[model samples]
Target: MYQLIALDLKAARKEKTTKQKESLAKIALLHQNVQSLGNSINEINQMLMDHDDCKFICITEHWKSQDQIINYGIRNFKLASCFCRKEGKHGGSAVFVSLAVQCLERSDIRSLSVVGSFECAAVKCSLNGMNFIILSIYRTPSGNMHVFLEKMEQILSKISDDSASVFIAGDFNIDFSQDSPNKQLSCSLLNSYNIQQTIFQFTRITSASESCIDNIFTNISPFVSNVINSSISDHTAQKITVMVDMNKPANAVKKRILNNERFLCRLKSVDWQNVFHIPQNDVNEQWNYFSNIFQSIFEQVFPMKTFKVTNRFTDSHHPEKIKNNIKECKDRLDVLYVISNSDNSYKPCYNKEKSTINY
Candidate 1:
């Protein structure tokens, strides 16, 4: 049974390639510097369509306003958390989590974010009986490196947990492919926290330049990652896979006392004659007596009920379920994105998808 969460972004059916689709461990992630999420929403959707198992989406340079991001999001996945520029028209970050996972936004870490130096959005994810923090970060090429390093340390210090892992993904604009003062200091800072840069392949490829500025940093063990050529920008994307124990109750377990018509009827059915005929003549004392009686009946009428909460949708492997949810997901997409960036509203941020080929 393949459980699902996150956006409803799907693509037309295609023949499966040699890509690894099934895994003994189920947690998978996809990271990209989309240039502009509004324009690249379709591409991002299509990418998730091909790699349907990817539950986490980390994006930098979303280039959308906080207002716009608040109004729109992908269908199946929850737009877990986001940070957009206040003054500038570009440079922002977002973290999307699967519906099957539970995460808490780390605003304490996010409050430390600054525009030019360090911009980030982080979430503490609790999945499959494990806890970890996923941070999506971005820094400008000309941004202040000193401030970036300082804020990064504070952010790391605040979120550091002995029991939880930390995963950082971003376009830091510092080329790890070449030796430079910026690269050295950044690597040293991350190394201090035992977080190592994971992607080694050149992420950006142009006829004139090739660089590895886009990367993922982590201290997680038993994990594997690869560079994927996304035609979204000069910057390529990345995918990370980790096997985690799935037997534990992971998603979310919630319990509630059902307050239904039966409860209401039972409450009214109670013998309230005693409350009215109480020995106390004082009005306050009589009300208190009624309250106690009401409380006693309330507890009896409503009993605690527990259930495991899971996302309504499931992964593509469950073809029948996925197909049925497609229409329902699209309906939600329409309401969230009333402007409708789904098909025809996109303007190419860098290269048009039709002109560029992605794997």
Candidate 2:
């Protein structure tokens, strides 16, 4: 019986190891039409916390201005790129890339536009030594579909080389479920460059209607893809999974910092006057003697160590107080939402709280 129990324990350990390996094998990405990130930014944060495996989040219809982006920043992930609507207040797109992923905005493609009717934000990054171009696009329903397609074609033409894989995920506003001319044209345009739409299920579900407007188009198929049912927003969040080795070494510089309090305490305990009374003829020798004593005290009190430089975005500078304030505002909003129910009373309160948090 003891031998059997030991075997069972061994099997459990092996199963646990296998589970850990499987969890580390893939990186999850979420794409969603937030409609207006300003109102539901807290929900996004909660979603991220719940889905810890998600590394990247691509959002469309953010309905946010350039200034508002600062307030909607997430903790670990950095806002790599954003294309806000120039004239109107709505219809914007943004990509938040994880710090673990080395990504930079593709300014070349970003600058190219078709009268600014459509929005697109691209980032070039390497994951596990494999290079990829990730784009988040949002096409306004009012925009000319032909012009949008032509602009997309132009952008695709520029990055059509077989060097890097491309992943485009967004709310195109073109219903792929129905046999529409726009859908056909979009599919044909994508197919011309060997890009395939991976999402087939209805991303936007409503009581009256359902459609697969939100999509994930990629040149390379993702290892895992699914539509997450969420009450965070009206539309469901689409998730794509890819394997990435996050163990890549980072280029970092080390610098020393002194713990002033500890150093002062150590200095207070020393007989400074005695140490300064060194038998030296030259002023330089006396200065050197003083410096050596200071250095010894500093080293003993405040040792130095190296850490990676990971502050690549403005959000990195946000203080803990600001995070706490944001959380408090979210909690208040939740309470107000529950109390108001179907009433419009929560709108004003939410807006007021949002302004306070941003401030």
Best by TM-score: 1
Q: Compared with the true structure, what per-residue lDDT tens digits does model 1 show for residues 1-359?
A: 12332222221122122122321356778889988888888888777888888878899999988778866576578888888898977899999998888887877667778896788998888775577789999999988876686677556544432235678999899999876656765775575456788888999998999899988988666788999887987788998887765443335422223343454355446564555475646645555555455445545644334345454212222445433333332222222122112212223411232233221
> Can you list the residue pairs that collide in candidate 2?
none
Candidate 1 weakest lDDT stretch, 10 residues: 10-19
Query: Candidate 2, after superposition: displacement of residue 302 in Å?
Result: 66
Question: What lDDT does each candidate get?
Answer: 0.67, 0.68
Q: Looking at model 2, which ten-residue stretch has the lowest summed lDDT?
A: 334-343
TM-score of 1: 0.61
lDDT per residue (tens digit) for residues 257-352 in model 2: 334445445644655455346664554555455445655664565444455645322212234543443344333333323222322544654565
